[model samples]
Target: MGTFKIEGGHQLKGSIQPQGAKNEALQILCAVLLTPEKVTINNIPDIVDVNKLIKLLEKLGVKIEKLSKSTYTFQADEVNLQYLESDQFKIDGRGLRGSIMIVGPLLARFGKGYIPKPGGDKIGRRRLDTHFEGLIKLGAKFGYSREEQFYGVEAKKLKGTYMLLEEASVTGTANIVMAAVLAEGQTTIYNAACEPYLQQLCKMLNRMGAKISGVGSNMLIIEGVDSLGGTEHTMLPDMIEIGSWIGLAAMTKSELTITNVSWNDLGIIPSVFRKLGITVEKRNDDIYIPAHTDGYEIQSFIDGSILTIADAPWPGFTPDLLSIILVVATQARGSVLIHQKMFESRLFFVDKLIDMGAKIILCDPHRATVIGHDFKSTLKATTMTSPDIRAGVSLLIAALSAKGTSTIMNIEQIDRGYENIDERLRAIGAKIERLD
Candidate 1:
């Protein structure tokens, strides 16, 4: 129920560091359950969702030692199997979507995995079919209670088999990979999610003695091992946050440098902004965005069609970032289409931007065409409510570039993903204050 009061039209300067990848931390933290030895993880983002997941792990009897704010050692030597059947377990497990991932490692190590239906951002229908089907393919007996909305899987022992996932779901792939690593035989997963998060998970697993090949491709080959050892891992910088900063700098006419961005891992994100006529300079492990004082312009296709920015799988634009792109485009020159194909309701936040005097056409649930303001006009600030994590940051960016003062409520949504966003932005000369 907190709010952000922002006085817009401030020129931000200096550099900021991107937080650890939220998606990757979710997978990497859960992977700690695969071994009983000490697994040390560094660069963990201190966000709400991640902290909830960590609390769930602590409740499961995982010995957690906080070596530092961003580093921890996890030893899952004595998991409380009885707790899985407790009502408290159901309540704790349902806090975040990443809670569902614990099922894979638990099923692999303890032969039983249980979870109540998880909760997360209400962007669209995020189904668990891929996770369920993939586990079932590995010889686990699956059961669901429709009345209670519970899911459980058990197996005497898992036997590896090839699974062609219906979709390259990121969490689904991570869950299955964790399960297959301890199964009896070889497992080949085709059409898998090869995002940098998954790649890091695979690499960590390999270091822990799992035989996994194809680290950065869609096809994964894993040969099950009897036991896995513990290892140390560091998370990559959050690419989505990096992209958000780029958009923020352009919209607010700021010069911001984001450090340790893992440029090789940010696939097509910088180029996507370039399509919006934003200047992105790669400095080794960082990305520098210069102020767009001359005005940012949208680039059309060679055939003279309006450019369309849409979300696809890994190498494609992430659905999480389309909202940021949409807000940044509001101040650019020319018109472009923002297509959010994966999620149904993610594009609805554009209505708020429209109320702020940005010309936007919400064509449908999935698409919105934005006509840029071309710097001749500035958005008039207004009170608004944040819809979700990504959209909340998008609105904050809009407020930063608007002509007057604005207040955004329900910034808890923003807090779930970005770490100390208001404080971080304030350090870079943004006029933002957090009100409780």
Candidate 2:
């Protein structure tokens, strides 16, 4: 196990570049199984989750070669489909939620796919029914084993049709899109998740001969093709990491510049941060946060009262970023309510913050009210363990603004999403040490 010891009460000042989106890279790598040609991917983050997925791919007989630090070439011309039924491969598939994405490409190209229960943050009950439902709409039949907790899908030939997903599940949408691209007819997906990550996946599939329309909208129209060729693609920068950095800078009253940020892709992040009184400047593709920002008061209606920051589907605030925003609100000038509508237990971590001298009201399992201290620096660091990827980063941000040193154990959760996090924070004047 690894841990992070952070000495708090320091103003971070430097420029940091965001890594490639972990979610997008995972799906894009799985898309390689749809074709037999060599595919090259650039700007892939060297993170634990990506590494695990690559290991799974290699075990499936995909010929992989590293071209550089952030580049790799993958050829799946001879992938052994038999490995999908092995115990070792099933264990590997349980590593991350992204592993479920392989089901679509495998079923589409090889006529069958097997995956164990996918593992990820235990925030709530993330159901895979959405994934299976969409695949079934595309002519795939599913079988499951309760004892082994494994799922299997088999289909001789997929015939595309209209699919109305129950929810805009991101991974579910990605899986269906990948499967539909090579089906027998056109597939139309309604209420699909069109986040930037999904957009990147669609664009990459299009470059490889898949016809997809409405790249950034809820309704996706995918025209099936007989075959797909290999092409080179680059992953998008991690917006979740960029949001975490913005929160870190604000909580510590620091000045930081984030480079290679897609300013145009940030649909509602700027306005959402503006509501919390954080000023972000965009210079070309970079974002600059000024030092010593006078934290703004939480906005309200005409009656003048506290407002709420809540999460919703795409085009709304992202659920993945709600943790960071809640932690940042702890240092603002006033109080605001944060509602995490998507997950049931995500708000439970606020109890840890209250123990660190933060004034928080746990309204329920999904909501909380946070009162800022105006840079009081009253929190005394203590030993804590990371709960999930987003909450783990939130705890690190809180620890960075505390009065003394704090230790966070089980940092593998943090490593799943953020790439070279300690190194990037160290470059920005944060005192963080990784220990075994």
Q: Candidate 2 lDDT, tens digit per residue, 1-436?
A: 8999999988899899999998889899999999999999999999999999999999999999999999999999999988998889878999888899999999999999889999999899899999899989899999999999999999999998998899999999999999999999899999999899999999999999999999999999998999899999988898899899888888888899999998877779877887888888888899998875565555664678787889988899999999998988888878889999989988888878888888889998899999988776457698899999999999999999999999999999999988889998998899999999
lDDT of each: 0.95, 0.90
RMSD to true structure for each model, in Å: 0.7, 1.1
Residue pairs clashing, model 1 = none
Total backbone collisions, model 2: 0
Model 2 earns a TM-score of 0.98
User: Candidate 2: how large is its RMSD?
Assistant: 1.1
Going through the candidates in the order shown, the clash numbers are 0, 0
Query: Candidate 2, 42: how far from true, in Å?
Result: 0.7
Name the lDDT value of residue 48 in candidate 2.
91
Clashing pairs in 2: none
